[model samples]
Target chain A: MSTRIHRRRHAKNIAAQVLASAATLLALAFLVWILWETISRGLQAIGISLFTKITAYADQGGLANAIVGSAIIDAMAIALSAPIGVMAGAYLAEYARSTRLGATIRFLNDILLSAPSIVLGLFVYVIVVLPMTAVTNGTTTFSALAGSIALALIGLPVIVRTTDEMLQLVPSTLREAALSLGIPQWKLTVQVLMRAAGSGILTGVLLALARLSGETAPLLFTAFGNNYMAFGPLEKMASLPAAIYQYTNDPNPALHAIAWAGALLIALFVLALSLLARTVFARGKTSHD
Target chain B: MSVASVTLDSNRGRDRTDARNDALFRWALRFCALLVLAALLGAALSTLWGGREVLFGDGWRFLTSAQWNPVENRYGAWAPIYGTLVTSLIAIVIAVPLSFGIALFLTEIAPAWLRAPIGTGIELLAAIPSIIYGMWGLFVFVPFMAAHVDPLLDASLGRLPWIGTLFQGPPLGLGLLTAGIVLAVMIVPFISSVMREVFQTVPVRLKESAYALGSTTWEVAWDIVLPYTRQAVIGGIFLGLGRALGETMAVTFVLGNAYGLTASLLMPGTSISSSIANEFNEAAGLHRSALIALGFLLFVVTFIVLLIARWMLRSLQRKAGKA
Candidate 1:
C-alpha cells in the first residue's frame, strides 16, 4: 500500500515538472517566432541601393541619408556623454563613500536612469527644438545637433550608473596602494581605477548606444523626421528608427519593404552589441579569476 | 642634534609631497563631480524653461480638458494621460504574474541543460530594438489580435458588466487594449530575466533543506523561495512597468491616436508620447508650448516612478543581505 502511494506521488510530480517545463518553453518559443518573422520580412528589402542611395519619396529610395545621420548623432552623443558620465561615476565610487550627499546623488541618478526616453525627448523638444524653431522661424526646425544632445542626455545616466558600479567593484586595497605610493587621487582614478574598470565601462557605453539607437519617440519631436539627405549637424537629417516609422505607416508597398529592412538592420545591430558586451565581460571575468 | 635635524627634514619633505598630491587630486575630483551635477541640473533646467509657459499659465486645468487641437491653439492633455496610465496598468496586470510564473518555472522545474539557452533567449528578446517591436506589432500581431483574440473576448465576456464594457468594440485591434497587450509582450522578457536572476540568488542550500523535509517542489517554491525573493520580484515588476509606461514606438503604432477617455478597451486612444510624436511637427506658437508641457508632465511622472523603483530595489538588496 505504501509503495503504491509513493509511486503515484512520484508520477504526479514528474507530470507537474513536465508541464512547467513546457510553459517555459512556450514563452521562449514566442520570442523565437517574433525574431523569425522580423528577419524574414525585413531581409527582402536588403540591396546595394538600400545602403548607397538617398531617400526619394517618389521612387522608393534608400536609407543612405538615415544611416549617415544616425552615425553622426550617435557619435556626437557618445563624445558628449562619456566624460561627464565617467567623472560622475568616479566621484560617486571614490569620494562619496557613506556621505549623505553621495546617497542623495545616487538616488537621483537612479531616477534618471530609468526615466522614459520619450520624456527626455519631450524635455529636449520643449527646451531646445521648440525655442530654436521659434527663434529661427521654423526654417531650421530639426537638426542632427539637437538629436545628438537628446541622445547624450539619455546615455548619461546609464554610463554613470555602470561606471560607478564597476568602480565600486574594484578593491579598495588597490586604491590605497596607489595612494600610499604618493600618487595623486585623480591619477589613481584615471590610470588605475578606470583601467581596472575599462571593459565594464565600455560594456555600459555599448549598451547605452544600443538603447539610444532604437529610440523613436524622443527623436520624433527633436530630430523631426526627414525624407532627404543632409550632412551637417545644423540641417535636418533622417535616422533608421524615424525612417522605419515613416515607411511603416505609408500605403506604398516599396516603403513598407524598406521599413522591414530597417527593422532587421536595427535588430541585428542591437544583437551584435549585446553579444559584444557579453563576450567582453566574459573575457574580463576569466582574466580576473 | 645633527641627526635629529636631518630626520625632521626628511619627514617634512614626505609630508609636502603627500599634501601636493592630495590637493591636485581633490581639485580634479571636485571639478568632475561638479560637471556631473551640471549635466543633471541642465536636463531639469532646460525642461523647466521650455515648459514654463504651459505649466504656469494653465496649472491643473491643462490636465482636466480632453481636447487636443493644434490648429486652433487649444490643448488639453487628459486624453493622452489617461491612455498612458490605463495601458500601462493593463500591461502591468498581465506581465507581472506571467513573468513571475516563468521565473518560478525556470528556477524550480527546468532541467539544467535547458536553463542557459532558455535564459539567453529571453534576454535576447529584451535586447531587440523597440522599432522592430513596433513594426511587428503593426503588421502581424495587431491583425492576429483583431481576428482571434478580440472576437474570443467579445464572445465570452461581451455580456458582463465591467468586463463587457471593456470588450465591447468593433474589434479593430488598433487601440489601447492592443497597445497594452503589445507592451506586456515587450516587457515580459525584461521582468522575467531580472526575476530569474534574483531567484537564483536564493541559496541552493535553502532548497535542499526544504526538499530534505519532504516538501514538494511547488510547496518549496511557494513557502521558501517566493518569500525570500518577493521584494526583488516587486522591484523587477516596477522596472518593467517603467519601461512599459515610457514605451513610445510600439504603442504609438497601434494606439490609433484618438484623444479621449473611452470605457471600452478596444477603442483607440492617445498617449503623451504618441501625441507628441504625431503632432510635434505640425504644432505652432502656444500649441508648441502646450505640447512641451505634455512632455514635461511625462517627465515628471516617469521620474517619480523610477525613484520608487530604485528605492524598492535598494531596500530589497538590504533585505536579501540581511537574510
Candidate 2:
C-alpha cells in the first residue's frame, strides 16, 4: 500500500476507535443516569411506612402487601420451575445427549428462553385463569398461582439452559468411573453429576429469580394487583412490579413517589442477585477447572 | 454353603430393586423433558383457541383494518402492528450500529485489563428490568427528548422535502421515536454481548494476517471479522429485533397508546404487547378476544423471528465445530 493510503486507513481506524469509545461511554452514561435518578428519587419517597403499610387508594399507604406478595409469588415460581428445569436438563445432558429429541427440546427451550413474557401471561390467562373463573362462576381467577405459573414459564428455560450446559461440562471420566462401580445411571446422574453442577445450577436459579422479580408484564393480568394484604393463591395479589406499573399510570403525585420507592427496591434487589450469581458462577468455573 | 446362598439371594434382590428404580427415574426425567415441549405447544394452541372468535369472525380484516373501538366492539390490529414494526425498525437501525461499536470496543479496542470489567458492566445493564427502563423513560428521558432531540429533528430532518412529514409532529415527548430510543437502549446490551462473543470467534491468525498486510483495525473488523461471523451477527440482530417487537411495559409507558396510525414518528401509538397489557385488564367479550388475537399474532411473529435466529446461530456453531 502507498504511504498516503496507509495514513488514510490509519485515520479511518482512529475514527472508528473514537466512535466505539464514545459508544461505550454513552452506554455507561445511560446506566449511571438511570441509577442516579432511581436512587435520588427513590430515597426521598422511601419511608418506614412505605414498608409497614398496605397500599391505600390515592396516597396513604406503603408497599408492605406488595413486597410480601412478590416474595410469595417469586418463591412459588422458583419452587415450581427449578426442579423440573433441572430434571429436563439432566435428561438432555445424560440420556439424550445425541438424540434427535434432545436437540429438538434444546432448540425449543432456547426459543422459549427468548419468547415474550407477555405472551406467556396471555397463555396462562387462557389456560389457567379463564378456566378457574368459569369453574368458580365469575369469581376472579386472577391469583398468585396464575402469576406464579406465568413467571415459572419464564424461568424454566433459563434453568434448563444453564443446567444443560453445566452438566455437559462435567468430565466423561466421572461418568465412566461411576458406571464401573456398577452404579445405576439414575443414581450416578442424581448423586454425582448433580452435585458437580449444583453451584452452577444455583447460579441459574438465582438469575431466574432475579429476572422473575422484575417482571411486570406477566403479572399484569394474572396476579392483577391488590391494594390490601392478601396471601391466598386464588386471590388477586400485589407485586412490586405490578404496584409500580399501576402507580406510574395514575396521575397522583403521591402514588408516583411510592412507585419510585418500589422501583428502587426492585432495582437494588435485582442488581444484588445478579452480582451474587456472577460470584457463584466465577467460583464454580475456578473449581471445575 | 447356607451363608453363601443367603448372600447371593440378598444381592439378587438388591439388583432387582435397583433396576426398578432406574426405570422409574428415567421415565420421570423423560416426562420432565417432554413437559418443556408441552408448555410451548400449550401456549401456542391456547392463545389460538382464545383468539379464534376474532380470528374467524373478523377474518382477514382484523389484521388489515386500523379500527379499534371497544365501545362499538370493533377492533383491528393495524395500528398496533404498524407501531410495533415501525418502533422495532427504529430500534434496530439505532441499536445495531451502536452495538457493533460497543462490541468492537470491548473485543479489540479496550485494554486487556479493562475488558472484563467493562464487559460485565454492560451485561449487568441487560440484567436491569425492562420496567425500570419504562419508569425512567416515562419520567426522565421523555422530557429530555421533548426538550432536545425532537426540536433538533424538527429543525433539520423535519424540513427535508420527502421524509419531512414523518418527522413533523407536536413534541409531547412520548411517541414512537421516544419509545424506539428506549427500546434501543434496552436491547443494546443483549446485541452487544452476542456480537462480542461472535467477534471473539474470529481466528486470531486471520486477524494477524490482515494486520501484517498494513490493514487498520477497522479494516480488519469490517473485512475479516465481520464476514467470518456474519451468520451469527445477523442472528444476534434478529434476536434483538424479536425482543424489541415483544417489549411491553417500556413501550407502554412511552408509546402514548393512541388508537390509530399517524404519519409522524412523534405521534403516540400502541404496540401489540402494550395494547394487550393496557386493555386485558377490563376488556370484555369480543374486545378481550381481539387483544388475545393480537397476542397470538405477536407470538407467531416472534416465533418465526427467533426460530430463524436460532437456526442461523446453530449453523454457525456447527461450522465452528468443524473448523
Candidate 3:
C-alpha cells in the first residue's frame, strides 16, 4: 500500500513537470508570435517617405508629423516631471523617512502609481481641458500642453518611488559621513546622496519615459490627435501612439500597415530605453560595490 | 588690521547667505512632496465634481441598471461593470495557474545557464505597451479565435448540458471571453514575476530539508513554498487583478463595444474603460459626465485592489525583515 502511494505521487510529480514546461513554452511562444507579427508587417510598410511626409488621407501619407509631435510632447513632459519628482523623492528619503505624513504620502503615491491612465486623462480633461475650453470659447481645449501634463503626472509617481528607494539603498553610513562634515542637510542630500544614487534615479527616469512613450489612453482626450504638423504647445498635435490608434481603427489596409510600422517604432524605442536603463543600473551597482 | 576685519565681516555674510539658502532648499523639497499629495487629491475631487451631475441625477439606480441610451439621455453602469468584473474573473482563472507553472519553471526546473535569459524574456513581455496588444488582438487574435477556437469550443463545450450556453454563440470571436484571454496574456508576466520573486524568498535550508525527507519537487513547491509565501502569493495575484481591472487598450479592441450583458461569455460586451474611451470623445454634457463617472469608478476599484496588495506585500516584507 505504501509503495502504491509512492508510485502515485511520483506520477503526479511527472505530470506537474510536464505541465510547467509546457506552460513556459506557451508563454514564450506568445511573445515570439506577437513580436514576429509586428516586425514582419512593420518592415513591409517602411520607406523614406515615412520619415519625410506628413500624414494625409486614409490611403496615403507618412508619420513625420506624428513622430515629431511625440518627441516634443515627451520632451516637455520629462522636463516638467524630472525636477519635481527628484525633489519629492529627496524629501521622502531625507526628511520624512520615519514620519507618519511621509508614510501616508507614499501610500497615496503608490495608489497613484497604478491608478488607471484613463482616469488621469479624465482628471486633466476636467481640471485643465474643460476650464481652458470655457475660457477660450472651445477653440483650443485639447492641446499638447494638456497631454504633457497628464503624462508628467503618470511619470511623477514612478520617479518619486525609484528616487526614494535608490536613496535609501545608499547606505546610511554615507549619510552619517556627510552629516559629520558640517554640511547643511539640503546640500548633503543634493551633493553627496544624489550623486551616489544618480544612475539609479536616471534609470527611473528612463523607465518612466519608456512608459510615457507608449501611452495612448491619456493622450486621447488631452492631445486629441491632429493630421497636420503643429509645433505650438497650444495646438492639437499628432503623436505616434495616437496616430497608431487612429490608423488601426481605419478600415484601409494601407493605413493599417502604417499603424503597424508606428507600433514597431514605439516598441523598439521603449525596448531600447528599458535596455539602456538596465545596463546603466547594472553598471552603477557594480561600480558602487 | 583693517583688511582682516573686512574679511571677517565677509565670511559672516557668507554664512548667513548659506543658512538662508539651506532653509529655502528645504522648503522647496517639501513643496514638491506636497505637490504629489495634491495631485491625487485633485484627481479624486475633480472626477467626483465632474460626475456629480450623473451621480446625483441617477442616484442608486445607476449602480443597478444596465440600460444605456444617448438619444433619450439615459445611462447606467450595470453592463460595463459586469463586463469589467467578468473579464477580470476570466483573466484570473486563466492566469493564476499558468503563472504558477511559469514561476515554478523559473525558480526550480530550469538549468542555471537558462534562468537569466528566460527571466529577462518574461520581463520583456511586461514592457510591451498595451496598445500593441490591442492592435494585435484586433487584427490577428480575433480572427484566429473566430476561425478556429470558437468553432472548436462550440463543438465540444456547447454540447454540454449545463454550462453550454456560454459556448453556443455565433463565432464572431470578439467577446468577453476573447478579451479576457488577451487580458490574461497581458497580466501573465506581472503575476509570474511576482510569484517567482516570492518563491525565491523561500529559504534554501527549508527546501534542502524537504528534499532530504524524500519529498518530490512538486511536493516541495505545492506544500512547502506555497505555504511559506501564502500572503505574498495572494498579494501578487491581487496585483495582477488590479492591472487586469484597469486595462483599457487591450480590451477596447477585441471587446466589440457592445452594450448589454448576457449569460454567454462569447457575446461582445463593454467595459468601463472601453466605454469611456469609445464615447468620451464624441459625448457631450450628461453623456460625458457618465463616462467620467465610469472612470471614477474604475479608479476607486483599482485603488482598493492595489491597496490590499500593498498591505499584504508590506506585511510579508516586515516579517521577513524581522526574521
In order, the TM-score of chain B in each prediction is: 0.88, 0.98, 0.96
> Mind giving the per-residue lDDT tens digits that candidate 2 earns over B1-323?
69999999999999999999999998999999998999888889988999999999999999999999999999989999999999999999999999999999999999999999888878877888988999999999999989998888888899999899889888789999999999998899989988999998888999999989978889998999999999999999999998999899899999999987788998899999999999998898999999999999999999999999899899988887887
TM-score of chain A of each: 0.91, 0.97, 0.97
Indicate the residue-level lDDT of B267 in model 1.
88
Docking class of 1: medium
In terms of TM-score, which candidate is stronger, 2 or 3?
A: 2
Top TM-score prediction, candidate number: 2
Number of the predicted model whose lDDT against the real structure is largest: 2
How would you encode candidate 1's per-residue C-alpha lDDT over A182-260 as one tens digit per residue?
6767678889999998888888888888877877777776776577787788787788888888888778888888888
On DockQ, the stronger of 1 and 2 is 2
Give candidate 3's chain B TM-score.
0.96
Per-model TM values vs. the true structure: 0.91, 0.98, 0.97
- Model 3, runs deviating above 4 Å: B1-15
The lDDT values for all models are 0.80, 0.92, 0.91
lDDT of 2 at A176: 97
What shift in Å separates residue B197 of candidate 1 from its native position after superposition?
Answer: 2.9
